[model samples]
Target chain A: MLKIEGLRAGYGAAEVLRGVSLSAEPGEITVLMGRNGAGKTTLMKAIMGLVKTSGRIELDGTDLAALPPHQVPRQGVGYVPQGRRLFAELSVAENLEMGLGAGPAQGRAATREEMLELFPRLRERLHQRAGTLSGGEQQMLATARALCLKPKLLLLDEPTEGLQPSMIGAIRQVMVTMRDRGLAVLLVEQRIEAVLELADRVSVIEMGRNAEDFSRAALSGAEGRLRARLGV
Target chain B: MDFGPYLMLAMLEGAVLAAVLALMASGLSLVFGVMRVVNVAHGEFYMLGAVVAWAVTTLLGAGPVLNFVAALIVAPLVVGAMAAAADMVILKRLNYDPERTIVATIGLLYILQQLTLMTYGADARPVVAPFNERIALPWVEWGDKGLSFYFPWGLSTTSYKLFVIAAAVVLIAALKLFMAKTRAGLIMRATQGDREMATAFGVPVERVYALVFGGGAALAALAGVLIVPIQQAHYLMGGDALLLSFIVVIIGGLGSLSGTIVAAILIGLSDGIISVFFTPTLAKMIATLAVALVLVFRPQGLFGGTSR
Candidate 1:
């Protein structure tokens, strides 16, 4: 489980996330929806400890905000940032190797083989540089790298932004599998279709604050409310 | 004397220069590649290696072979540890900001040089090579006696000089293996690719930075130890070494190890061959001009592609 309360964070002096609060429980996909510049990415960065935060960021019972950025991932958290920030110079297999170091000691081989199965394209290009991959392939590599962490909490930021439909469907299936396996999936997405398909719970943000929340039962009739709140 | 023997001699000298220069410049390139800081005190580290070698050889009072071997092992280790400490204490404090670190290293340069002067003195000192047996080289010519091979009068090289070239090749091959095969080397490459992302992935980036700084210093120190037998240790020798390394790094492309090696060879051979034909001054001028041309046309460097 991951919980953030009144989190205030941003680059030096200019706060982008102004008192935003959200929670993501295990075995659920909680999608964060917001317009551009509404601090969705800022909130994610704050969670990752990439930016300084003043409020509480707790993973399970542990205070995540108190830990350094490098230590945060060791607490069973996986992150795929806005850009597919793969180590450009490293080969595809090497990128996955990095994620393995942060993951559980048990099932190390199984985890690597499983990720390769999930993205067969990566297997074909195991020795190729990550930077040379196509946009869709790069996105697959990024998601696979994060999944290699085998985390209890996964944070993905705009993963489907530039991906093809088939790739997006593949990503949606993986998210569902992870959720079924009792992992908390906190996603930031712009596509309503994707949000509707993957979100078990939706949290909307406006001007860096929580605007509304809808459970899966309420989401069916909340489409108009969500569109109006998101202004999309 | 025939031009053939002279050219061969010049080539031999150039290989020695290139070998040492490659070791030193590779250190500079690694630091710049990973930490993104220009270490102006890199040459001082080289000087430290030579001075430390001298000190160790003198203290041990062993045979030439034993003393040289001991110095080879001791100098790099000592210099590497000192550099790692400096990285943590000084460069880390500056947050590795480019301009600030350059200035900080400049301060380090003077401090190292002055300290050596105060202790080691201003006089240049030579460390004896393990062995200096000279073997005359053969030259072939189509003279009155068709295709005759003769030993040229002055065409010879010492056994230790040959050892230096072999050592550099072995060291470079080892470095490549360490980088391409080991886990720690992978971590360093990860940090080099993206610092923030490496941190996000649970890499201890600060520690990696310190290790890289130390490793780079060790390489420079090793080069110093190798060259001390041929070029006497002097406090000011670092100035010219630093200049030549900067030229090689720029021409080879910043942060590219292969490029650095290629550029070192190009510059080193030109320096030797050109000096044989023209004045040493002219050779230096030509090298400097080459740098100017590289900067103007291929600003990204000869082997470099899109900027990082």
Candidate 2:
């Protein structure tokens, strides 16, 4: 399980995530929903240790907040940042290899062959530069690159933001697979359809603090309340 | 002497010049490509190599070939370690801010140059070539013998000069393979492409920066060692080298490796050939004019992509 308790973080003086607490259990997809500037991304960055934070971030009894950012991924965490920040100039294969590199791998990373199988579109364009790939393809590549880490906890920030319906379906399927395999998926998303389809639990953050939480069963009963909180 | 023989001689000299210049400038380009920091102390690294070579040769007091061989092995390693240390102690402290690093490296440049002058003194010192046996180059003539090859007068080069050219080609090829086929090279390219993404992906960006800075200085040092036998080592020698290398790096495009090599060859050969026809100063003027034209028309450089 991945857990964050009263996490406060931001760039320099201004704190974006203030006293927010949440948890995503194993074999479950927990989506975080909030309006713009509500600190969803800040919470994700705090979990990844990309931003300065004060609070507890623990994964499977290991204190992640104590580790450096580069060491964070080694503790069974895979991150696909908000923009699908693939190494643009590098070829698709090279980018995948980077995920499977010696620095990131902790004996459980996926092999190149396994990743190519997972994203078949990447197989044909293995040698193509990541920058030239279509929007959907880049997202797929980004997701696959993260999966190469074979993390027990996957943190995806808006993976389907600019993707097409088919691509969204493809990524949604990957999340389901990961959840079924007993990985903890902490996703920051806005699309209610994707949230309805994949979320086992939903948490809402308002102005950097946890406003509400719901399980899949509880979410159906409280749709109106959740929509009102989300302002959508 | 026939113009043909003179041109051949100039070409041979140009090739030697191109070899050394390419090695030096490629290091500069590599540093900029990976760290995005301009190392003003790069030339001082070159000078340090020559000075170290002189020290090694003088200390060994052995056969010239053996001493030269040892100097080659020691100079780059010593200089590389020094440069890496400097990166950690100085550049890292500055956070590699572009403008601050330029000023910091300029300080480092003076410190290194003055330190060398204090120890090695102001006089230029020469290191004997390992083996400078002259080999007469043959020329073809359509005279009475009908395309017979003859050893033309004043058409010969030293064996050491040939070795310099061959060594450079081999080193560059090795560097290419290292970049294209190795895991370490992939990490370097990854770090170069996106530093933040690389850090997020578990790359030790700080260590990589130090390694690149060291590697780049090592290349400049190697070039210094190579040219020391032909051109004597002096504290001020790095000034001209720095200027020429900057010109080559700019003409080739900021961080393009292939372009650096191509521009080195273009500049080195023209320097030799043009100097043969006109004065050395005029040749330099023409080269400077070329740089001006390239900058005005193609600011991104000859091979630089529109966007870095």
Candidate 3:
């Protein structure tokens, strides 16, 4: 249900996502693979309306190009940015409340409850200040906060970075459950195997242009070739 | 034969007086906390409240209870609305320029004082007690040979000054609770903590500025109401309180409510005690010097908890 056409974005003078294009369908995990500075995060931020973006960005035939950051959630976009930028001093509960915004839509708290059930460890520390939480716990809190917005498309940036294997497994299960629940996910992570394992389709980018778009099954057997391309 | 009674009486008077000063300073402190705007017109708000109460009671034939309560409630709310109007007329146009806003408010201060003088004529308008009776405080006889001290009991016990103290304590407590408990209070705190982040949260920051200014004006108005009973509701009442409130805020730590209360009490007691022994002018001079010295040593005042 998400689409991007000729998306061009940058911070200031230096252009990052140079006329890139990609899309994720309903109930599917679309993995975006790229190097450290290859504009993966830029594309996600552009979609969330957090960064300056030009060209076409739409979901279900509606443009969200000029919407403010706070309005992005109402337009069916949920973002979990790198570093899990949770409001540091606020408690997990308050942080979650903030994600709910001033809008009067129902099920915001119920969605949080569902995320807590999925990440049951968060259920215990529901009232703890987010700054006091461990790295994995903070990531979960950030992810859980975004999910509470109840968006149709979720953009996750580096969800596995600096996280333990168990947490990564939990995130994978969450993604699968959410996909089955008909929530489209645009997954950005460094873990090639984990991403490939979950994504229904994969799109690789090099220097802001799409290098390849292939089904997850096609990339499964060509692991050696991809490792050679990555030179790792 | 004993000076103990005189000293005790002086101490009691000082506390009563200090409570009045503390109330004014707390209002100034709250305004500074969130908006970071130093409202020079704060004392004018207080004076106007006192003057308005004085006039309303005397002219309308209202009793002290009704007059006093009405004064407290009406004056601040009116002044707060005036401040809100000022926001639309003047401050809103200034766009957070502290130097400009200060000049504008200080200008408003002078204009208010002048207008009050022009209308009320330079006489000290007298406000009477509810019942025309002089009650004497129980006299503490200390010396022999008919050399005795009379601490007046009747008026002193229910002095408008004491009433102001009770009101001040209640007002401050209510404000404290309102700031901590409400949703709007959360928005205010967040704005004070980090304005941009709060704005990003979709809080209208301009509304915050207006509310803060209104709150400050309301406080000054309360101080005005407190002073109406004991002091004459003269136009110049604002001047003395205004300068003193500035020193109180600085001594208390900028934008700290608790600090303002403590510092105000300290300064008021010092002002009263020093005034008893010395001329009022000299007492103010010494108090200013003392505050300067303390601030030199501890720049953030005693409670040093600024919002930032």
Which scores greater on DockQ, model 1 or model 2? 1
TM-score winner among the candidates? 1
lDDT of 1: 0.91
> TM-score of chain B, candidate 1?
0.98
Provide the lDDT at A132 for model 3: 89
User: What tens digits encode model 2's per-residue C-alpha lDDT throughout B99-126?
Assistant: 9999999999999999998989999999
Q: Write the per-residue lDDT of candidate 1 for residues A40-145, one digit (tens) a residue.
A: 9898888878898999999998999999889998998899989889999999999999999878878989999999998999999999999999988998888888
Measured by lDDT, the strongest candidate is 1
TM-score of candidate 1 on Cα atoms, chains taken together: 0.98
- Expressed as tens digits, the lDDT of each residue in A1-232 for candidate 2 is 7878989999889989889999989999999999999999888888877889999998988988998887788787888889998999899989988887623444533467777888999999999999999999999899888888778888899999988889898999999999999999999999887788789999999989989998899887787898899899
> Order of all candidates by TM-score, from best down to worst?
1, 2, 3
The residue-level lDDT of candidate 1 at B189 comes to 88
Report the C-alpha lDDT of model 3 over B1-308, residue by residue, as the tens digit: 13454454555566766777787887788777777778899998888887777767766677666766676677888888887778667887987677898999988898878988898767777666443343345665646766676664332345554555676788888878877667676667666655644543455778878988887788888777777667878888888888888888888888878888888788877776677666688879987897888679888787874334
DockQ top scorer? 1
Candidate 2 chain A, which ten residues in sequence have the lowest lDDT sum? A102-111
- Can you tell me which runs of candidate 1 are displaced by over 4 Å? none
Backbone clashes in model 2, listed as residue pairs: none
- Second chain alone, TM-score for each candidate: 0.98, 0.98, 0.87
**Model 2: residue B200 alpha-carbon error in angstroms:** 1.8
